[model samples]
Each structure stands twice: as structure tokens, then as C-alpha cells.
Target: MNHLRLFLLSIVVLTSANMLPAGDWPHWRGPNDLGAAEPGQSPPAEFSDTQNVLWKTPVPGRGHSSPTIIGDKVFLTTADVAAQTQSVLCFDRQTGKPVWSTIVNTGGLPREIHSHNTHATPTVACDAQQLFVVFNNHESAQLAALDLNGKILWKKQGPFSPEQYKFGYGPSPLLYDDLVIVAAEYEKGYIVALNKKNGDVAWKIDRPQISFSSPVVANIAGRDQMLISGLGKVCSFDPKSGKQLWAVDGPAIATCGTLVWQGDTVFASGGYPEKETMAVKADGSGKVLWRQGVRCYEQSLVAADGYVYAVSDDGIGYCWNAETGEEMWKKRLGGSVSSSPTLVGDLIYLFNERGKCFVFKTNPEKFELVAENQLGDEAYASPSFCDGKMFMRTADSTDGTRRETLYCIGE
Candidate 1:
């Protein structure tokens, strides 16, 4: 009987391996939503425009949205400013050639956005069957589901004007089971969970304050909770019912990074209005473990090996003890970072606005630099890894050109 049990377990493991393979950045922050790469996939530690790069494809228009890879296809969103159109694009994962392009929305403006924000700023998400995209066109917002072949499955829109915020909208959709959840928080912001199969609204809630932070789902103890941080509150909701679970005071007037979870504790940081970081209990207790002045505005926090790592917007890197909130180490990485770090094995890959990719070891004892490489232009989006390749979206040109390009880097 024991021999038979082992045999069945081996079959299940083998079958699952063949189905998912070693790499697939199906979510904006990798499959696990923690920005960690799959095990045993050692992407190149250093690469430039002419180094280890497998392919470089030119993407039309401009956007800071990160690339999402699933199976053999890579998905991204972009906006053609002159034409007044926002689009969802899919490309062949291996060859970097355009597979298909579909426009999600066209024309609809009267709102001025931040110089750094774009209409196509949100990253796309994909489940097993369809790809999801979100866009806010000044007066309203729309969420659409597309088939793997680029056909629209269903699209839904709601009233959302970001003119009051001045920075525009930049949050992405979260795919939770059969629901595509989105948080559109500006003046009079709200959260919506849509039926993934038919684009129907499953649940909705109003947010008291405005923020740009994306929502994240974390399983604590034994229950799954959806966490949304911004509007000066750290709130958890029922992903299935859209019911509010609990709320705590978050320090930021505007936040762009999602909460990072470790054990039963969750960590959040705010950059605008205030530079603060807080670790709170996730059991709806509203208990604060520790709060500090360390601010990581744009980049998200990464927790590993009992330490939470962060790189501030202006280049200050930090490693804090996740439990005690004690500072482990800090160093200036030397460039502005709007992109979050991706953890692969023992190393963390951090991209700066100047196109420099900084690789370092994730250690609590000290700061150690591994390697630094350039993409030959500006890179505002985070890096995505699949199999053995690193996909990065960079500015069209280093000389201030307006186009955007997605580059695939590997051995």
C-alpha cells in the first residue's frame, strides 16, 4: 500500500510539472504574486542591449505596464497618444514577434495626467482561458477580457475621473479565481470584483480616499483575504463577496505598492504625502506590529528569510527584520526606482528609471552588489521572468523618443 501511494504521488507531480513548466510570469508579480522567480531557473545575472538578449521587439505607443507571460505568449498594454487609442498586445514568447493586437478603447480625454503617468499604465493579467486588461480614459474606466487568440470576450466600464488626483490612474487588475478584481481609487474611488466569465459585476465597494495601489490576495492562517492599501487605510476584504473584513490606518495619502505578507503579518509603505512603513496583523485585529519612517513609495516590498527588502524611489535600499522592524542594512543604489525588485533564488533584480538593472544578494547582514547592466534606455516597469528569460519594457529610445519597446533577455 505504501509503494502504491508513492507511485500515485509521483504521477501527480510529474503531470503538474509538464503542464506548467518551470517559468510563466502569468501575473504582474509572477505566478505566486510575490515577485519571486520559479526555482532552478537561473536567468542571466548581467545583460545589455547587445549581450545575452534573445530578442528585441519594438512596441507601439507608450506605457509603463509590465509584460505578462503565459505559456508561449507574452501580453502587454500600450497607448498610441497621437491616435488617442489604448490597446492590448500579445507577442510570441520565443520569437518576440507580434501575435495579435486589439484596441481596448479609443478617444475619451479631458483630464490631464501626471507627466510620468500614461493612459495604458496598468499591467494585464491572464488566467488559463482569457487575458484581462484595464484602462481609465479620463472620464471613465473599462475592463475587458480577451481570448488567447486576441478576440474580446466581454468588456465592462464604469464612471471614474482621475482629474482631481492630478496623477491619473495606474492600478492593475487582480485575477482571483473566477473574478477579475479592480480598484479604481481617485476622488470618490471604488473597488469592483467582476465575474470573469461574463464581465458582470459581482460586488462593489466605495473607497473613502484615493490611491494608486494595487490589491493583493494573501492566505493567512487558513483563510484567504484580499488586501487593498491606500486612501490612508489598510483594508482587507472578502474576495468572493466583496465584504470588508477589517481596516487600519495606512500612512500614505497616495500609495502605489501593494502589501507584502510574511507569516501572519503584512507590511505596507507610503511615498507620497508621507514616507512611512508599517507592519500589521492580518487577523482583522488592527494590531500594529511596528511602524517606521522608511518609505518605499513606488517599489513594492519583498519578504524572504525573515527580512523585508525595499528600495526607495530615490535609490536607498533597505533590509529590515520582518518581525522586529529593526534595520538590517541600508545602501544607496544610485538611481530612481519606480520598478520593484524581482527575487530569484538568493538574488534580487532591481531596475531603475535610468535603465540600469541592479542585481544583489538578498541578505539581512549587509549590502552586497552582484552585477549592474543597462537596457540602453529608460525602464519604468518591473521585470518579469519565465523559464530562463527576463522580459523588460523600456522607453522607445534613450534620446527621449516617445515609443516603447519590449526586450526579451536570456542565454
Candidate 2:
């Protein structure tokens, strides 16, 4: 089904229970934006090009952004260096066919980016009515809202210049009720929340530091606060008021991983000038529950039960008690891993840079590998799940002639 038809059908079936369907990955991680797949739906443990692979389609340009799914359509962003264009692509969730591709920006870049980072590093977010995308257009960052049919509803410019981040931008927009919050952490940091209806500035907070970590919202102490880590601190802000509730100083500097929230505690890790992993109280007390030397600079940690799991950039998987910071188990999964693991039921799905997909049990007792499968030549972008299907993006060939592909695995 096309996007327009799906939107119309959704309006007719719009009930309290069906507002956000169980099988819609509306954001970077998933519906909850916490790297959790839909319940009762299991993607295959083993899949390859010819085994359990539903479909494989060629993506047009280079993108480190992951796929976002809403109802019957999947959304992703890509940038073509030669053409100097950045685009938002929509594909049919079932058929793996192209639905529409909308160019959101044109012209060359304003500054040089890191070799590993692309201009389209940020992932898109979606709500019931529209899709929100962030593009670093030349000097200014642009946030746009588009209908399901690829029509632009509104567009607003962010607060920072691209040149501020010498490396590049990697933060994705966080969508709450009727606001889309974007973080621009350069030499000077600012969190801007735009009105989703008409793209006006709703609230903005200024923090002077460089960061690449994305913000996540969690309910703690009967309030919803947005969490972001960088510049020697992990701060919590009132999502509705944009007021700083509390800030904890640490050894953080330019963090890449997002925080993992479980119950009344949240775990955060950062890499670069400093290496530290910490679990902090989430009740606005600014108390550090525990601190450790373990770090996941690039990939985010996943918390389940009473434990948290993280795969370092060098491919070492560590499971620790979420509250005590004691190590439960540590094992090595070969090859570098930048993609965060997705938790489904009791199994954790981890993909390495070499395209090796590792399925293991999220056991706090020991490291248990259930299955290992190879999918592509290289994959840095994380996977998304919806309706029992898994979507992955792979870009092979480090040279200019890169072959970017999107794969759908199921059954």
C-alpha cells in the first residue's frame, strides 16, 4: 500500500489503542526510542543474502542514518557527495520498493567532515501526522516536516552553524507530544525544540560545550525529562519547559552514545578525551549511583531487567549490573561495532562493521551466543524493526564507488 492510502486508513482506525501501532518504528531506535523492537514479533536469528532474506534494494547515496518505519512505509536519509544533494527516502515496508525520494538540501558543504561521518548522519523522526527530518544544510541546520506523501509541511532552521562542529553532526531529533527537539552541540551547545505543527521555536536552551550524543526522554519522579551527556556533564532538562532540572559533572567530552534509562536510574558512557561509564539517579538528585571505566563511545547501551549491555568500539561486549556498576560478564565479538544492539524479547541483536550479525541471549550470568550470521561487506548504521521484519543498511567499498544497500530480513 502507498503512504497516502495508509494515512487515510489510519485515520479511520484511529482509536486509543491504535494511535501508535505495535509494529511502527517511528524514531531512531523504535517507538519508545529505546532500541526495543515490537513485542511478540521475532525476527529471524539467522539471515543472509539468500537465506531468510525477504528483499534487498540499492540505496542511492551514502548515509549513516538508520531506517525509520511508520505503518507501511520506511523512511531514511542519504547524501550524494557528487551531486551535492541531501534527500529523504521512503520505501514500501512490505515490497522493499521505492515510494518517494524528496531532496531537502542542495549545494556543497560549508566545512570538511570526519572521514567516518557523513552529512546525513542524523536519523528522521515521525509522528501520527508527519515525518520530521534534520539536515545540516551548509552553515545552518534545517529541520523539516513532511507529509507521508513527501510534501513539505514546514521547515525551520536550527540554532548552530555547521562549522561549529569540526568533525560533523550526528544527533537525531527527539519527538515528543507536539514538539521536535534537536540538539546542536558544537563548541557552543544549544537544544532547540520546534513546534511540530508550524515549525516555530517552542523552547531553546544554551549549553556551551561540544557533543554528538542524542537526547532521550524518560519519565522519572512523575516527570518527563530529556537526558543529554557531553562536555564533562550529563544534564537532565524539563522537556516541556526547557529548564535545567539538574546537571552532574563528569569527565565527559564529546560523547557519542546515548543514555540508557531503566526504572529510576540511567547509565551513560562516553569516549574520546575521557573514558567513563556511570549510572546516575534520575530523580533530579544528581547523585551518582556508580561509576566505572568501561565506555561505549559510539554505540548506545541497552538496559534490560537489572543489567545493561554495551559493545565497545573495538568489539568487546560488556554486561554489568545496572545499579551497582559491577561487571556481570565480558566477551569479545570480533570486528569493530558501531551499531547499537537491539533488544527483542530476551535476545540481543548486534551487528559489527564487517556486516557480521550476532544474536545472543541477554543473560546477566554469562555471555551466550545463539547464532552468528553474515549479512554484508560493511554496516555502520543500526537496524530497525517493525512487523516482525528487520531492516539494515550496508555501504561497501571505501572508495568513491561505494555500493549502498538496504536489506529486509524476516521469517
Candidate 3:
């Protein structure tokens, strides 16, 4: 089916369950990439490396990607550095026991990546029946579909060369309807949608140089548009035909975070010193409502209750009024932050690179730090919250010492 038809069909499927209670963190940045959890709930405020952890599973290899939890299963990807193997690991959500591990076919090539980058930066997405994963092996990139039981259903490899960045490919794939959207922006900047059932090309559009940011799907002006940021530009496109609808230039920093949207306004930010954050009106014509500069990177924005919250890569957290682009307040967080901030009710949870997480109030007038905890390692992967628990992953240190601990933080 074409993308338009698939989108229409998905609307039907989604509406029937719209009223049903939903709480699965099935992909990056949670459901719909909004970063808002269920209201009136929070992660445990006082958990150390060993305390308040319901379970800790040692994942194999190394990866900075976050975990995606559905129903009773949790899915993530990791790279075997010495063996040159890329695989997906599935674990039981309740017990943290290994269910299965599927080795992905990376073709015949030596895996080339930055020392800090891995082959598993993209988080997997899934529906009720199947799971999807993206593997970039330097020479080529491939997207694979597998059954819930680990059987490979289909695989599609790209004919274009892999794009080289200071880091590796960090853009995760987004699934909309029956198509899987993957951003190949390095050697050749393009956004292509593949048939989810058979891995066929549904639509492809060539784009300019963009950074390692993922694309988001949203309803703009009664039409469905894919929002993407990179190459000093934030643009929207028709998902079915890849037609550019509108765009606005941004800062020079490589865009590495998800865009946050509330009603008709979309917010994006990146860069150091003076990071640029803008609230653009996505009303089919793409107008800038307001723009502000803030220093943030690699961290996605979270919107809730008319406020947008973000933590800078240098460890500063700020809350902004969503409608008017007014700064509420800013707080100086002491650790470096790479993961995004997730809002649960009136509280904001921020996980930092130094293995510390800070809990603060999501107030619009001032800053309030409620609690702080440490993990005793480096954390690059964002936390996944589901069923009143937060899942966190950390990077291994130098000297070949691997630490693939998955901590389940709860009360």
C-alpha cells in the first residue's frame, strides 16, 4: 500500500484504541516522542547504584541507545566490538531475563565507527506483532523486521554510502502506519519510507546535509507532515510524496534532539554558548512565532501543561512557556546532560552523563530541585518509564571494561 493509504488505515486502527488505557514506552522518547508520562507519578527519588533497583540485567556489548518496552518485553540493540556483530537483545520486562538475541546480517565489511559511537544508536520500534531495527555498519545501512519471537521477516539494505560524522549514525527510525521512515543523512541526505510488510520503497526524497536527528510525525494544518531538523534548517515534508512543504534555517550546530510540539507551535534547540530555541507555527505555511537562544544538545524537549522543559548538554535546565516562548526559570545542574528530560505530572526527571539524575518541579515561574541521585557510571542512553519504573543504561569505560547494566528504578 502507498503511504497515504497506510496512514488512513492506521488512523482507523488507532482510533478504536484511543480510549483504552495505554502506558507502553515502545520507542525512543516514549509514545509519539512526546516525553510525557502518565500524570501524578514519579520515579523513586533516592536510589543509588544498588538501592531501589528492582532488577539489573547485564546487556552484552556496548550501545548508547535507549530501551523500548512493550507489554511484557523490552527491546534494545548492542554491537559486538571485536566480533563485528550487530544484534538485538530482548528481555523479559518483569524479570530482566534474556528471552532471545538475534544477530543481524551486516553484510561483509569491517565495522567502522567513532570510538564513542556504536552500531546500536537507533532505538527499535514495534507494533503489536513485529519489531523493527536499524543497523548502520559504516559501509552500508540496513533495516530489518523481525517477529516478536525473533524470526527475521524482512531486511532492506541501502545502496548509498554511509555518511561520516564526528559521532556515528544516531538517528532512530520512526514508524508511521505501514511505512518505516529512516533518515540517511551523511553521505547522501535523504528520507526514505519503506513498506513495513515487505521492505519496498514507498517514497524517497533527497535533502541537504543534516545532522543525526530523528524525524517526527505530526498533524499540521489538517495534513500529516514529517518534522526534521539538521544542516542549519528545520523543515517539514509530505510523508507520502516527500514534497517539501516549508522550512526555516537554524544554528550551525548538528541537530541531535527531537522536536517538541504543542498545538500549532513546534520547538527545537541545539548548539553551545548560545543554543537557539525557536517556537515555529506549523500551520501549513510554517511561520516563526518566537525564537530564543539556549544552550542544549542531544537532549529532547518535553511539553506538558503549557510548558516546555529541556536540559542543556552542559548541565543547565530550563522551563519555557509553550505559547509565548517566555522563559519561566533556569537552574544550574552540576553534571553534564545528554539524555532528554521526561515529565511525569508536575515533576521533571533529568538523567545526566555522569550517572546522576535530578528531579525537579515543572513550575512556570521558578526553579525547584527536589532530589538528586547517582548511578556511579556514565549514562548516555535516555531513561524509559513504564508501569511506574524507569529503565536506564550506561556506557562502558575505557580499558575494555564493559558495563551493560540495566537498572529498573522504582519505589
Candidate 4:
């Protein structure tokens, strides 16, 4: 079905009991946004080089961005380091066949970035009518809207050039209402929203200081508020008007994970010069309830049933009391973690840097490890769960030639 017809149709007819309709992961943190997929999907938690693999397709180039699944098409952005090009790839959702690739930027790829960061690190966000992506090319942030057939409809440059830091961009495009928002958080940073139809600028705000976090819009404290951490604070913005709702200090000056919430309180954690995880009241009160010295950094937090769950960089899974900042449980999972956790009903799927996935339950009482699935030698992209299957971007090196593959896990 086309996006217009899907929008006109009743959501009751489209959505499942507790998930977005169509089981499409439209953006960075999936459809419902808090890194969770549609419940009741029992995609195999165990898979290897051969076991339980539905279809395996080779992906060109490299990126840390996760897969964005919409309809029968899966979308991702990749950059050829040698060619200095950034492009988007489309794959047939069922057969794992390459549909089309559109290069958004050629040449002028930033020279210096963290070894783990990429020119095409941001995940594409698609609406009913267009696909939106951002790339840090030409030493600035470029936003583009593409059609489903891999055609660039419009590309515009936003104000972003980190003279001091130069870490590259990490925030994925956030689709809210009719706007596709993008954040580039250097000292002369900006959070801008553009019209999804024609790529017209809607609203823009300046942010000082540098950070790598993504902007997330959630309905918390009884209303819709946009949350992003960094620039030395946990900040909230009105997604509609580009107004600052509130900001609280601490959670460090640099972060990568998007903000997650439980009830009226939202949790944020980060890495940089310091480490801290904080719970802030989201009712425009600028009140911070609790904080812990532990950090999640690149991995975002998932909270449910009055508890927040996170995996540390040193390979440990932890659950904390959501309201009281009490440590509930911690289990060492081994290896470093970078991928954010995705929750499917009671189960949360977490991937470490070594491409080992730890399947565990979302219980606050104790650490519950369900299964451990290993796929490749390295992985930084989080898995996208959709339609009873998993779209994972993994890589294995053979004789120093690293090959990336997009694997459809489970039957």
C-alpha cells in the first residue's frame, strides 16, 4: 500500500495490539522509537554463519547506521572510504536482493573522524511519501529527501562544521508531525526541522558545544516533548515550534545514545570527560530526580515496568529502579557494547561490539539471560526487528578482506 492510502486508512485496521502497523522500523530506534519492535514476533534469537539464516545479501561499503525497514524495502546508508562517496542502499525486504543505490554526496568527505564513526552514520527516516537522510560531507551537514525508488528529490546544507571537535555526525533524522528534524551538535550546532514534502526549512535552533546524541520525540509528562542529551545538559524542546521546554545539567558534555523515558521521568547517560546517568522530570519543571555515576554512553537505555535497562561499554548488563535510581541487577555479558537494546515484549535484544547478541528478559528483580547468538566478527549497527524477522548488518573478516552482509535472521 502507498503511504497516502495507509495514512487515510484507519490505524485500528493498521496497528497491531501494541505496536506500529505493518511492523515497519521507519527510523533509528524503530517505529515506536524506544528501541523496541512489535511484540509477539518470535524471530529466532539464535543464528550463526549458517544456522537459521533466511537470506544473506552482501552490503557494499561500510556504516555504523542500523537498518531502516519500511514495507517490503529495507534502507541503509553507506560510504565508500576510498571513493569518498556517501550513498543509500535499498534491498528487497524478502529476497535480500539489491533494489537501488543512490549516492547522496561525492567527494569532500571529512578527513578525520573516530575510527568507529562513518561519513554515513545517520540512519534514514522515511515518511509516507519520502526518504530522509543526512550525511556529513563537505565538512558540513547535508540533508536530502529521496523517493522510494532511490532518487534524490532535494538536498540542502545545514549549518554544521565542527572546527574544534570534528567527530562527524551521529544524530539520525527525526520524523515528527510533518517535519523531518536533524541535529548537528558542535559548538556552533543546530537543530533544524524541514518540510518533508519539498524540503523547506521549518524551524531552526542554535546549540552551543559538541555532542553525538540523537533527538527523540516522546509523549511524556502528559504531552509530546522532544528530548536530547548533550551540550552539558539534558534538554527538552517543543517538536512543533522549535522552542526550548527545559534543560538540566549533568549526563556529561558528550553522548551518543538517544534519550529513553518511563512515565513522567526520562533517563539519559553518556561518555566524555565524565560519566553519569540521570533521571529528569519531564513536566517543564527542570527537576532532576536521581543520578548514578555509571554510564551507557553509545548504547541507549530501555525502560519498562518501573525499571531502566542498559549495557555498559565494558560488557555488562544492568537494570536499575526507574524511580529511585537503585541498582537492581548487573550481569557481565563479555566484550564491549555499542549497539542499543531493542525490546520485543518482555525480551530485550542487545548486541556487543563483537557481534554477539544477548537475549534477555526485561525483569527488574534479577538479570535474566535467555540466549546468546553470534553472527560475525564485528557489528556496530543495531538490529531492526520487523515482520517476524530480524534485519541485521554484520561483517566478518577473511584474510583481512572485510565483507559486510545484511542478514535476514529467522524463517
RMSD of 2: 5.5
Compose the digit string of candidate 1's lDDT tens values, residues 1-103.
1344334323422333113344677766776677777655688998998899899999988888999998889999988878999999999999999999999
Best candidate, TM-score: 4
In candidate 2, stretches whose alpha carbon ends up further than 4 angstroms from where it belongs are 1-19, 162-165, 398-400
Put down candidate 3 lDDT per residue, 155-227, tens digits, no spaces. Answer: 8887435444535677888877778889877656678999889999999887556367888877756778789
lDDT of each: 0.83, 0.82, 0.76, 0.85
Instruction: Report clashes for each candidate as comma-separated counts.
Output: 1, 0, 2, 1
Error of 1 at 171 (Å): 1.0
Better of 2 and 3 by lDDT: 2
Model 4 C-alpha RMSD vs. true structure (Å) is 4.5
lDDT of 4: 0.85
Q: Give the residue spans of candidate 3 off by over 4 A.
A: 1-21, 106-112, 159-166, 251-253, 272-274, 395-400
